[model samples]
Target: MAAKQYKAIGEEAWKNNVEKVNAELFIFTYGSLVVQLVKDFEDYGAVNKQLDKMGYNIGVRLIDDILARTGIDKCADFHTTAEVVAKVGFRVFLNIAPAIANWSADAKEFSLILEDNPLNDFCELPPKAVQEGLWYSNVLCGVIRGALEMMQMQTEVWFVHDVLRGDDVSEIRVKLVKILDEEVPVGDE
Candidate 1:
């Protein structure tokens, strides 16, 4: 399907099918979750890892929701995969379709430029956390990684820039490692 068609599907689903929630409640809840993670781990890096793991679990299930909600077929190429993810997946989930940009010459990597991240809404990392390399939205990288893994696209996703980290825009870099045609169970392999 074309990117525009995906966008239309996302818009329609978000408008009519999905249940609405209080945006502030969601944001505050996420903020408190981060706070609790930081306190529990006492290490910014560990907090980030925990957030990523949580998001990965969410994404593993989220892909199923996207497939059921939009009924789009698997993307045939990396370019189309990028488009469908930007136009459909993010939109249906966050109501914000980040801009896809900075494609590599090989087209194996690209950046998702989030002009506005709901997660970063009203979030500011402290100086110590910033110095310790806390990616305020690291969860998103895990989400993308897990979601694409389900799509048979092995990818490395991470935050290259974060608005909460004082960058002009939040950027998530996604690099396609390889496409998996088949897999072995770990012990069998």
Candidate 2:
């Protein structure tokens, strides 16, 4: 189910709404939403799950917008999907300066290790960060899993490293997992 739509506005119109744009800003503010929304909703335990689902919902919608923007056809396989992610998705959709060469393909999936993570490097999380639990990039992870699922591929999002600590560099890894099993349509009248 979709979230409540507040004041429908077009993409072009959105640019003028500074507060709304800042309200949905993801790069430097992913955690803030999770923290605030959890308390606002009064549900902390389900935060991660909600984040994942929300991310997937974003992917489902943004993938179509992205494909339309780049004029690229749907990728047919995992490799092609990964290529699209690096060349088109990352570059156009996220406006990321991806070197594109450092990305690697593994047995189960491809990994894009950004030499500079804009989200993490954009701002420093306070030492002894007060928020409870892990500060994972739930939005990005959700987008990837959601977009891939739209392309009919199953995926899992996991965090391999965090730069919150004094690690010289942080690493974030995502791997494509298995296809979801088909379920019979059950009816409740």
Candidate 3:
């Protein structure tokens, strides 16, 4: 099955990579950063947008690392790309593989169902944050958007469900806007 292959590949890639960090420390640091953002902005929407922007920046850099580590060549289609993102990408980086589901009729959109979200581990939104409709994992949406963009795939990513907000399942929706044509540099052209 694809899942088994993905797991094996992910595990191998993870082991080969020497650099590592403690999960607890990483999660806690991210949590602290989120709290600070909330305090500074005092508006949940603004904070969410800021977090997305930050994640977008991170994603742009991360895709290069991912390509180098995974050695996966350009994906031929969105379906293959989705599999790579869900199976290899998330598994390698987060140690959790979200399920790809809810493909649209045209296959231009899909949902990622995260059964386990590390960012939410030991995270509980304060009453104010919840009241203000803060999405604790907004950064994830941004990351996906940014990473896809670098791959010449324009997409809109957003969280549709959050367990922190009392949703039964955490889900992120990704809609493909368009695939960009590869551009040659001035001299290369």
Give TM-scores for every candidate, taking all chains together and pairing residue i with residue i. 0.94, 0.65, 0.93
- What is candidate 1's TM-score against the reference? 0.94
By TM-score, the best candidate is 1
Residue pairs in candidate 2 whose N, alpha carbon or C atoms collide under 3 angstroms: none
In angstroms, the error of model 1 at 9 is 1.4
Could you tell me the lDDT of residue 112 within candidate 2?
A: 62
lDDT of 2 at 116: 62
Give per-residue CA lDDT, model 2, range 47-76, as digits (tens). 656777788899889778765654556565
| Model 2 alpha-carbon drift over 4 Å, by segment | 1-31, 38-46, 97-106, 126-133, 179-189
Candidate 3: Cα lDDT at 64: 89
* Backbone clash tally (model 1): 0
Best by lDDT: 1
Query: Which 10 successive residues of model 2 have the least lDDT summed?
Result: 1-10
Candidate 1 lDDT, 1-189, residue by residue in tens: 777898898898888778888999999998999999999999999998998898888889999999998888989899998998898888887899989999999999999999999998888889999999999888888899899999999999999998898899999999999998867778996
Which stretches of model 3 miss by more than 4 angstroms?
A: 1-4, 185-189
